[model samples]
Target: MNRSTVDVTFVVGYLAVAIGLLVARSNPATTYEPSIYTGTPMITWVTFAVALAIAVGMALTCRGREQALGIGLGAITVTGIVSLPVIRNYRFAGMGDALTHLGWTRDIVAGELAPHELFYPAIHSIASVFHYAGGIPIERALLFSMVITFVPFLIFVPLVVRELTGPSMAIGAAAIVSWMVLPINNIATHMGVHTNSNALFLAPVVIFAVFAYLRRRATIERLPLGLSPFSLLVVLSGIGLLLIHPQQMVNIVVLLGAISSVQYIVRRRSDDHPILDHPTMYAHTIVLGVVFGLWALSNERFRDALLILVVGLLTEDVGSGAEVDQRGSSLTEIGGSLGELFVTMFLESAIISLIVGVFVLLVWLGRTRLAPEAKSLVNYLAISMVPLTGMFVVYFVGTPTMAFRQLGFIAVLLTILAGVAISRGVGTLSNYVSRPGGTAIAALGLSICLVLGLMTVFASPMIYDPGQHVTDQKFSGYESGFEHADEDLPHAGMGYDPYRYDHGLNGVEGDGTLSGATVDSGTVDSEAFEDGDYADAYNGIDYYFIMTQYDITRELGVYQELYYSEDTLEEFERSPEANKVISNDEFRMYVVSSTE
Candidate 1:
């Protein structure tokens, strides 16, 4: 078939898959079911399987570089869209960090700054702009924001790989593999903390620009009209990173610092000169760091958080022991088993990519002299793994799951390395055979490997079961309870709303009022309501909005300590002074008459 026909067919197929997934799944407010592939309904699985087959077939059959690139790009687009249905169906505009982000965005759209004591406001500001300018709903604005932040990484992976290794099938392979590989942060599928996700998206672009500058292909020299376009882009990206996410800015700085340090060390050892001796290269780094530091210091909330984190790290008690206890045993107690650690790291790193990355790194290290560009690239990759390794060690000490975010950067780098390794391996194998059939056989073997890798990566969510997604019933209940409270309570006259709960409510003003308040099942202590203490505590609030125990346990498992037991809920329900105003299977609203 002609290239245009092939491209058109892939586009049509991708749209069909996207539509099918959206239609097949029930809305988030309906029922909670296991994921599409993991649960029942034979047709859903069959449709997904067919879509995968088509994507794989097109990618393997493509003959030209352009066709291959199209296939790769199409596959990434389809994968992203397929996951969106689940994200959209999430009850009450997502769960966990997603809900918090949604709340921030809502406040921003309402033209209120400092809505919450949030460190990163760029994502919310961007979403607010989209909501106002595009006249779209908040949900759609948030989803579109996610898409915008995510698409850059998709575009960058292939382009960067092709640029580094030259145009070949390896670029297509790298693109598809990296897109499919499960991110350690789970940011790709689950919409939480858009700042980190956005930072990740911008990472490769910044890296490419830095590399270009080093190669002398781009510089900060001024033209007759103005500053060079390439130089302008690099500076803007650096500033953008500073504003978007602090952690991401730190990650980028560490990455750049590592690269520069390695380059300097290698040059000194080999009697070679620095690639970019101009002051502009260091200027951007210094400006970004200084601006971020000044902003953090000026903001009291950010400064306190930084101090707390620093204290926790220094004390070696950064995270709670609950996570470590959940892991069965502490790494320190076991003396850190290398075999077990390797297995855990491999699973989190996308197994295929990790294996290929290690193999390629070893192969490259064994060789003697190499081209300057190749050597520099190899050294940068090696140094990039250090921070990830440190995070892995921290995971063992405490905060096992949180370490996955650090591993995400490693996964991206490894996927690219894997692609290069596969391409070189296949090319070497093809040289030994005399006929065209040998190349075909090699291609078939690689295709099978790629298909299996994709399947494994896709199945990870089901196998690990992170429980990031919540059922429609529970989410709706929690949302309804909050909405009822907001409707019943007096609107804020000039300042923050009086009614509050432990969690951040989307439309509520001021910070939550349930600070240090504890509840069991659906009830708090009777003394909490006596002698006007409750009213004084909640800014003269008389009504308390509470969620059912089942819903709380299911949806907010991480906040279990904040919930009351069933016995406590029943005890409170029987109290004479507390009158129930609204009651449902999912939530309960009570009014303390004495407080009022």
Candidate 2:
């Protein structure tokens, strides 16, 4: 197939993906328990397969009729996969954080909650606007805001590439990188409606828009209103970024600051550093920093959080959040968990990094052949690696936001480098292979590796855990279960994962820790399940809540702790001392029958 034929195939494949999403929506009574992974029809993955093939075709194609539509293939693929749980469940997307965010957005829409009270309120505010004004549901509206956040990234990343490489393969490469799920690096940056994620999607646009303004500052100033299109984008996207998540804006500012400072140093050394000739924008960096500092100072939550973190850093354990002694597990158990964790990390990050790393090497080899702007970009990325590693270390050692978003910033840097490499690589394909068909075959071959690798990050893991999505039924089970319980007394559940039970409890269990007792041994004895002697130490264990998450957790051995299952429940029931207190379709609550 030639360029035109491949472009047409790209359009057809994308259409199939769209149709697949609609067709794959879960039945209303879908039981998310046993496995949402297996529940997905094979057709869904096939649609993805088709998408990958066509994306490669698009990457290798020249000018074509579906250029615009095809350029967004990557973004569409990302937004589509992210939307699956939301559309299928017809509810929310993320596990616990998303639930809280949706609730926040709802309150904002109802005018019961003001945006200023929250640390990062841009997403809630935007979702509220869509919900209240556009008459969309807060859940749908919030996710729509998140998934649609891709539009700016879709538009600007290629434009940013164009600024350096001047069009062609980079446009397609930029879209393909979107599919790479680079910035959505870890659970920290969830592939759903989220504040940090909003920043993730907007960072490329904001940074490039700033660069665009820098390149045309003189020309922009001469405009009648002194605001060009790119200037408007900087203002709008920058403010949106500021309001959404200041931490990420801080990260972006640092990157731009680094590049601008590098640009200044290069200009001082002139011809000696032509590769570092990217335009400087000290004013832009300073303004962004000042506005961020002001917001940080004014926002009590952010201020207090930072202050506490700093004080804790100085006075207490440098990384108290990573305490293993407190996990109530033996050193061996902890070591095993750490090993398993490394495996997950390797699969989640290392696979993509290997691919990007190869491309980055290609970029360096072809550095002299690159355009000046492209050379500057390559230099910026190459130089930025050392500092970005330091930044990652600081964040990785510092906070326990549970989102590990710092890594995503580093991925953004790599994604850009990889985009440049792909642009150059594709144009040079004729040297080694034929034009469109051979190129498409090679691209598809590469894309297959990407799709398989990205699935590890984007989709629910096939084995370790079930879906993280909090379907309406699960939400109801939690709401009604907790409501029916005695809040006056303490209780425990099988799975006390920070994410698993919290969304169900709807923040009633702050941080989602178990309330009952000192039974941190993966399995704690209930008053009935244990003898009077062993159970006497922690008599506060009144009720035991057993749910499907517990069943699954025990089944898969997904947690370092949280070992309870049907066998345990059967043992509890067999005890003459056990009393069945509350039972629901999704949850079971029991206490000592002999006691009050």
Candidate 3:
């Protein structure tokens, strides 16, 4: 094959691997796939094969700069949106704020007209309206929202980076950083089924707003497609962010504002006026803030917090424990962590990414010559650090865990900037090298960065194990033949307790005979099923093993009821209202709606 063919093939292969990394966590068995890596073993293999095929296609179709970039982004967008159907079984929006989304649907179905959680009033309220329109289920409506929101990053990130840097750098940077940011492993694994997933949609919109605002103020070219309606678009995006997660929305605004202010400061010092002085900047900011603020007022919590922060009476706490109340953390902490969460997303996931990003950025800074425009870009990036630092200060006052989670967006932006820096570095070095030498040098640098990034993506999935959490209320604990009840508990921060519940025998049962079985060799469908006895007769009843409840509430993560037979189980006539003795293991066991 010719050299061009070889390069194209390599690109295709690399992209395939990238796609695998993106969906590696999706579970196939469940309607809401959750994280494949976290649930069914078969799902991982399926996702791997699918990702590989897509990557190969990307490589084969590689053409000129713009087309190649478009293809790569299009792949992510298509896959992300297509994956929505995977979340079919999700209920109550699937999890966290998703509950609010589902709650919206419930109210609509019942013909009630009110909101649920304060955190996501807008999304929930809008979802209610959609349900009233009468076509999709609550789950489908949220999934649609997720898919629609996911598409822009595919288009906007590359476009923005290209505008700021060059086409080649833009695409490469977009790919690397996106790999870190988009499917934040921890969130996808344990939490995406919850309301937290909806907040992620706002990220791309926020980035797009910055891109549009920057272009409006900085670029001399004719207005982009969204520029004419920039203020409206930004307002909408802001409202979305606010409705989904106000704290995260705050982080985006603060970070963007900080960057703009920095650019303005540096430019003014240099006797220049880049976009900071433009009345349009302030106009966009005010309108966006107002629209979202009005929506936030619907939630009393939001209104109170906003009043406290805006009035200067309350600043959010920074370094409290994992169980520290959400009100303790500032708006900046919530938002900033979303930006920075990529690194510690799940142990080593962020480490490899951070190394690659830092390496690339240093290389670029050392080797590349910065045009005045690039310098301005650098200045803006530097200014972004200010609010990030402020977030750190907030961390000191409240929860360190808050800082940990907020790093997702920051990591992406940082990694992308680093990649751009590397490209510029290569370009700069080329200026000094003879033609042949420059080509060789640039090629070498690109290959190294790409290799490192791919390695990080592939290895990230390994950092977490798929074992279920077992505890007292859920199961009877490790003594009951369930493995990993005590392992990997999130003792320090507000993280998931990766455990599963097993039936335990009772103190509360009147029949006092517990019967159970170990089914399937880890596969409930297989021959590993066997009967066993529990010390307490009431163990035949259904239960839950909540890792967070046990650890945080310090209560039994397992619970069982007394039973005499399958049809006639004994009940405690006056067993007191269920209460968690320990706040950490605050879980309780109850009859399940269904087991299949």
Clash counts for all predictions: 5, 1, 91
Which ranges in model 1 have alpha carbons more than 4 Å from their true place? 1-12, 15-29, 32-48, 57-69, 76-83, 86-93, 114-118, 185-190, 219-228, 271-281, 316-322, 327-350, 368-372, 391-402, 428-511, 514-596
CA-lDDT, candidates in order: 0.52, 0.60, 0.42
Question: Which scores better on TM-score, 1 or 3?
Answer: 1
lDDT of 2 by residue, 360-407 (tens): 666667643676666666666566666666776665455644226777
Can you give the TM-score per candidate against the true fold? 0.72, 0.82, 0.58
Q: Among these predicted structures, which one has the highest TM-score? A: 2
lDDT of 1 by residue, 1-596 (tens): 77688767776666655555654553333434333333324544455555545554455445466446455545544454435433445433344455556666766666655633456776777778888899976655765666666666667776666655653556655665655544433423333434665566667776666555555443356666655555556667766766666666666666666665665565567654333342244445666667678766777756665566556556665664655454335343334433554444344344555556655565567642334464456456667678757855664345444455556666666766655665555555566874344435544554555444444432123233223334444445555555555444422210112222223345433444332111111333333433224333334554453444333443233222232334544555677645776565544556544345
TM-score of 3: 0.58
* Count of backbone collisions within predicted model 2: 1
What TM-score does model 2 achieve against the real structure?
0.82
TM-score: which is higher, 2 or 3? 2
